[model samples]
Target chain A: MTSLRHRIQAAAVAAALAIGALTACSGGGGGSANGPIEYWLWDSAQQPGYQKCADAFQQQNPGLKIHISQYGWDAYWSKLTAGFIADTAPDVFTDHLSKFAQYVDLKVLRPLDDLGPTSDISDGDYQQGLAELWKGQDGKRYGAPKDWDTIAIFYNNAALKAAGVDPSELQNLNWNPTDGGTFEKLVAHLTIDTKGRRGDEAGFDKAHVKTHGLASEGSGGGGWGQTQWSAFAGSAGWQATDKNPWGSRFNLDKPELQNTLSWYFGLVRKGYMPSYEEIGGANAVGTDKQIQSGTAALGLSGSWMISTFTKLTDAAGKKLDIGLAPTPIGPSGKRASMFNGLADSVTTLSKQPENAAKWVKFLSGAECQNIIGQSGVVFPARPAGTDLAIAYNKNERKLDVTPFTQQVKDKTTFLFPVTTNAADIAALMAPRFDAVYIGSSPISSLNKLNNQLNDLFKVAQ
Target chain B: MATATPTQQQASRRKAPTGYRDDTRLALLFILPALIGFAVFMIWPTLRGIYLSFTKFNLLTPPKFNGLDNYIRMVQDPVFWNALKVTLYYVVLNIGLQTVLALVIAVMMQRLTQKTWLRGIVLTPYLVSNVVAAMVFLWILDYQLGIGNTILAGLGLDRLPFLSSDTWVIPTIALINVWRHVGYTALLIFAGLQLIPETVYEAGKIDGASEVRMFRSITIPLLRPILSLVLIITVVGSFQVFDTVAIATRGGPVDSSRVLQFYIYDVAFGRFQFGYASAMSVALLAVLVVITFVQYRLTRAESSDLA
Candidate 1:
């Protein structure tokens, strides 16, 4: 019996070894000779649109293929960094302003200046400020502009009407640092308690809010709250940094920014908005779901969420009427929105650099941008493509997304901060912001966090 | 065959050279593959990690030797201190609750006459993936929309903040850990219980001893070894808790649930501070080793005392 057991165990070991060898040998390496361009992106919402562009690119270049891999926002960065360490990174990938600075410093990204038709792609061809956003510290372009997004107020028209507020009244709402101006009044008027009292009413129960007047994203504030509170802070004249890409000092400790945060969290206390516990909790749903379920009247969202809002339905199975309005003007007498964009970058490790560069060129060119615009997932970075997207949303979805486009045209947009060590800045600020949102710590806590962030920035310098 | 005297036969048995040598060689050959795997995967990585702890590595750039810099930084980091405290709190709560619950469940299961299938049903939680289990619990514990909150509201009680409050996050995580792992712990204890002879219980009854007395004298003494093993296992497992916290709390609401492992992950991946993370990991390893050694000594002393 012992001899038989030994023989069986030996046989099993041998079989496992053979299987492992076969599996390892069968695995193909990425970006090898004749291998397809390994492209990666984070936005699954825009994957189908890009897949269509890939199909066209394949037809135009006949033997070359582009394989697209999509990951969620957090997983994408983590896995991409791992891929870089393992020397198995994608040949072409979509890059973000927040991360591209670090990538440029690492020298893992190829400069687009010497690549295919990069010179032909002039500054005016794309949306204003987008082409500039992709430049590294060395004054070399690292990415080709793909799409841009700006913040806006997405309101439930039915909820607004129920509260006896006109949709156009939302368009002209202005905000101040102290009272929040007409915007605060509108939010309070729209807010309803379980006892059927408005937020502004004396008998309104703060403990049992049935529907919030406004919903921002979850309260884990990083360096900035782009779509959540940046519109308020930026309009109140709080710049994220002293300068663009390579700025060594962060402006988070500024009083204007702190006041905006205080007032935003104060809405939670008054039951005009959801608390951090409700919004950032494990069971929390997105802003779109909140509006669809009659839990929130307005959501401060980005233009990228236009399609998601358009598809929402109420409890009666009727499509909810979604309205878009510009962000409230603040004490500076101007409205502001965070203008962020995505770009396609070629990896320095690509086996076929020329091929990868050509693919990026096609992806960011006018033809693909028009195709992407028709999908209405986001506004293309090209001005012509932006108009096409506006037209598509109006004609097909019957939704007006002009508020987002108008931010770009009217120049009321502030660029999302581009800096090295952004990830460190975010990690240090998140918990502090969480404390402020939950009312455990005062807004002055940001002063200390800003100091830590500046210290990290100094290391980058 | 020839008959031999007792001494001669004993000598011949001891001198069975060919068969003994062959058996020893075959046994060594059988274990060679496993030994190779351990050296390549486990031992090599451990040595590499130790080396990395003394260097500055961002992964994109090649590592540069910066002796003790990473360790020095860890000593001064307030976040590191917070993480260590959170990790210890998690370990204590998780191990304490799970150990008591598991023992109780094992005793109950042993007493059960019918429902043999119930053992398998209880183990279903252990079979579910960690990520899947976390997601289910997240939904179940949601403040407004969760079933737990709904039940709380129905009972006319305020909704408990499971993942959103600093005070409750660690306990909530510990509860989830207990729920997921108690079945496995129970099974181990139950296996030990089965190994206890039925005749011992009969003897105890014959002596007119009470059930509690028999359990204390016979069962507890005999079950010492298994209990010690379970204690060590639980301690090690609880110290390394990460997945549930990552999915549920994300070390948020002011870093209340930021255990050491999650902190290491954030520093390495979020901040790209690989060398610093390695140093922190080494520190954690030292803690685990000391804890395991202390448990080992305690168990050995108990067993010796029984002997």
Candidate 2:
């Protein structure tokens, strides 16, 4: 009987410790000039490139050093927030446009304009609209733009060949809310049944698909579905919220968005895509794994996942040949992609704020951007950096990354919604999105959520 | 076996000799560190949490008093209601299955195999973290390519969506947690079983009472205190479940699996609504308190029939 009591006691202790750790300020010994500027990032792929940049940065500023800490996407925000509450936040940390607003709202960010080194970079210095996302409502720069990513489609070459689909047909794939266009047709062809019949063929079995035409995006994609339905909806002249950065209203209630979502989720019904229930589990399988396992023939994904898709191999170690293509042209007569970027911001708690700003400035500059681009991990914020990555991809990786760049070139991209209450908004819409995906809830249910969503955003009377 | 005879006489009735100048002083001195540790780690945080429930604090900003606002919001919030409902469903299912299985296993082990090695083997899953267990099950129970579905397919059976379907997710997660916890629960019950005298069974056999009757009349009646203890502990633990749901479904498939604790976590950490989260936690604490009290009263856990 004491064993049960002991177990309860142990659980209590663990809970207390967890709470204590979150509130405890464990600040480092670092206000000194010679101390390393604490830098944090979430992406491990870009770790080595940033390490190289850190090394170069130290040499350029003699006696100034940079310490880097990396965490995964989920851990990064919680850790950062905890660190902030505890006054132990990193001196400088990479920031996503989607998450940037909350910190600004809390006054935890140190504006870059106050720093001398950051003065050189201007609106024109970075990729289009990248600079504008970092601006607070107070007209201060919260971050220095570093890198950008756009969405595209990753297809398995061997899978396409096995399904007797031509690679060229992928280039001209189109979509609309009325009908799924050539994109759906190609997807259906690639969707083979276990009995060896295509999705478009007679006597095709949707229940036991040998391979799904499209993979799940690993989530309900929150308020916006950049890699899921955003591209299609955007091409249909629909935006997630009424505006970017500080939109008080939502367009989720729009017919364009609903019809677009209906068609997108209808693919699951037709067996072109995996049902949400099939793809959901512990750490749900993303497009990267789905495509690699030959579960999905095509995966619409972000440019940041370029490397992950490229290096996929089966259980037998047979390398998968992944091809890239732009998203299908939708009703607006052109393709669309959600263009988002990451930047570095100096934390208000940073003891060595000036040094942190300098490190952030260096990261934003062409020199470090070029290094990041050369590593072929990400497309750097500067055009020079993008050019380097393009060259590196073409020369070393034998991969053409122009579909991502072409969106930037053609200006057919919209910014990921950047506003406060993002988490509240996401939580509100997520279940509804899941319901729609699982085919249990109607798409028009979004209209109710959309009304509730604006209440959180405090949409103007 | 030693019988647990009534020791009704109070052992703590002696006077404190001249204003606490004897063993009491020494005892207080000896227990001072532990008291301080408990206060700092448990009591202080709990008090702070209660204070926060009445305020509006986002962790970054200083708290502002907002009387009953969070409680009001929670009452009106459909997600909160859904979370509470789902959590109750999960708790009832998990506790019901786990207690039964744990009791059966404990009885079987007591009768057949009392080997320490068997106990250790049974307890293996209890030691594994919820995250690891959830991941292992995810691989085994996955709808698309899991070994479970493969076996089902080989038998010409349709694949079941274990963790993904809204209907299946709650039961699946409950089963996962039950698997992780049943061993430890069984061990606790086994410890209670050891307290039963072997002579009781001998007497029952001599009296021509069946084993099942002996178990029902003697073992169960004698085990009431421990069973009630186990129920209180497991029920409270089940309601506070977060780690498995966090690692697994993450309250998905139309929020069918969003347990109360998970929702509170999302409010605090995910959405930074610490004040509202604190209020929700306070409500959960109150619920657990009432439940424990009710269980104690119903089972008469304070009085033992051992003697």
What DockQ do the predictions score, one after another?
Answer: 0.30, 0.44
Quote the positional error of residue A317 for candidate 2 in Å: 2.5
Q: Which candidate's lDDT is highest?
A: 2
Q: What is the TM-score of each candidate against the true structure?
A: 0.92, 0.94
Clash pairs (backbone) in predicted model 1:
none
Candidate 2 interface RMSD value: 3.6
- Give the CAPRI rating of model 2: acceptable
Q: How close is candidate 2 to the true structure, as a TM-score?
A: 0.94
Reproduced native contacts, each prediction: 0.33, 0.47
DockQ of 1: 0.30
In terms of DockQ, the best-performing candidate is 2
Proportion of native contacts present in model 1: 0.33
lDDT of 2 by residue, A133-215 (tens): 99988889999999999999999999888987888888888988777889988889889889989989999999889789898
Per-residue alpha-carbon lDDT of candidate 1 for residues A1-461, written as tens digits (9 for 90 to 100): 32223232332222222122222322222575478999999888899999999999999999999999998887788777766766667889999998998888778899998886564566678889999999888889999999999999999998888889989998899988788799999999989998889999999998899999998567647637886789999899899889976777978789999889899888898899888787645334778988887878998888889998998887778888999999999989999999999999988878888899889999999999999998999999998888899999999988888789888889999999898887887788788888888899999988988889888856655
Q: Could you tell me which 10 consecutive residues in candidate 2 chain A have the lowest summed lDDT?
A: A9-18
A-chain TM-score of every model: 0.91, 0.93
